[model samples]
Target: MSESHQDKQHKARQQKVKQQVDARIANATEEKGLLLVITGNGKGKSTSGFGTVTRAVGHGQQCGVAQFIKGTWENGERNVLEKLGVEFHVMATGFTWETQDKQADTEAAQALWQECKRMLSDASLDLVLFDELTYMVTFGYIELAEVIDALNHRPAHQSVIITGRGAHRQLVELADTVSEVRNVKHAFDAGIKARKGIDW
Candidate 1:
């Protein structure tokens, strides 16, 4: 066969293989529910979590959200999600750095975690977002073993999303999908405060 003809045949074979792979991915239903862990030192961790919550709500799925470190009043996402009947539980102690009390923060985190655990185990909830959850595990404020147990024990058809910086290796290993949001750049580093709708 001519060299060009051979190259064309190889390309055609590669296209056929690609089509088969795509078909498999499209038809595969072995894994329906997912454990998604989003972690990194950049911005938008909770934002990404909330985005997923919104998506789930739009799809007529019951969703729950538990905020770990942030408990400040009236964020746009919370307001929108609340209007959609999405369940939300905040830590009520605000950020750890602002509180400057480890014990107090831990206690608040534990309380919120209890609610999150219940939501996670509930088969009625299609999706549960654990916002800033990595902070609890990273600081040892919440028991890692208990968290793993709750995640593993959740309903087979339920999806869970955990977002925060410094996610534990064990949690990452347990997760069905893990996404690391790298910090390429941020306005905060340039002396600009977080903007409404965009940041919040």
Candidate 2:
């Protein structure tokens, strides 16, 4: 066969495969919820978590958010999500590095984790966002076993989203879908601060 003919045939075969995959996805049931983990050294882990929250709210699903290790300022995402009737819980102690106290950070993280636990068990909540929760496990602030237990015991139809850098391998393995956002470029490196509505 000529090279051009082979290329055309390959393209046609690829299109057929794509169509099959798309059809399968389109017909798939949306009722079965899954645990999702968004992790990596790159930015946007929390951003992705909030994006999922927005999607859930847009679908008229009740959502809950527990923010760990971030409480310095009023983030736009938090404001918008709260306005959408999302039950938001923030540590109010800021980042661990800024607190400069391991015990204090641990206590704060534990409190937030407690709230997350409650949300996980609430069947009425369709989605729960564990924003920056990986830090709790990474820093040994919250017990990994407890976290796993809560995840496993969550409402069957509840969709959970965990986001942060350096997520535990066990958590990633437990997740039904894992997405790692890689940082190709960031404005912070160029001395550009995080902007409202975009970075916050």
Candidate 3:
């Protein structure tokens, strides 16, 4: 009832939380690279992957990114990462909605998959970002088994981040950390078109 009483309760709760968190942190002794999957219908999947890439670059770690879908539109993250000496690769085009020519898309995705394999095998890289990789496998552009094999065989110290919607069940299960960004509401839902600098 009194303000002092409320303050005492809050402090007690804070202390309890601190103790729990500290205990968990102390128990986490094993250190190794992680396989992280960011998937869902939400818009921040690629953003989150790129954000991690920026963090890796900030740590002066070798990093590589293979953009499987996004077109040649100017990318701020790629520009900054490349400036920071990150190895970045982008395909020739983004996914196109069409009635025919699925073969072209598959071929392009296969090419990117090869690049992804190279990046995965590079022992020098501390982190690798496979942007829109889920779509590649889910859409049958690349073999899911091949993707999983590469990821599983990557260097023990190499961390990876996958971003896209509809991530394969096997990939999600293989990931040490998996986050599904839910879309409660989006600007596109509100009829607002994507804008540069904000969307990109």
Give the candidate number with the greatest lDDT. 2
Per-candidate local distance difference test: 0.89, 0.90, 0.89
lDDT of 1 by residue, 138-178 (tens): 89899999999998889999999999988999999999989
Clashing pairs in 1: none
Better of 1 and 2 by lDDT: 2
- Candidate 2 weakest lDDT stretch, 10 residues: 70-79
Evaluate model 3: give its lDDT: 0.89
Candidate closest to the true structure, highest TM-score? 3
| TM-score (C-alpha) between model 3 and the true structure | 0.94
C-alpha lDDT (0 to 100) for residue 143 of candidate 1: 93
lDDT of the structure predicted as candidate 2:
0.90
Worst 10 residues of 1 by lDDT: 66-75
Candidate 3, clashing residue pairs? Answer: none
- Residue 86 lDDT in candidate 2: 94
Model 1 Cα shift for residue 109 (angstroms): 0.8
Residue-level lDDT of model 3, residues 77-151, one tens digit each, is: 877889889998886566546324678888888888899999999999999999999988877889999999999
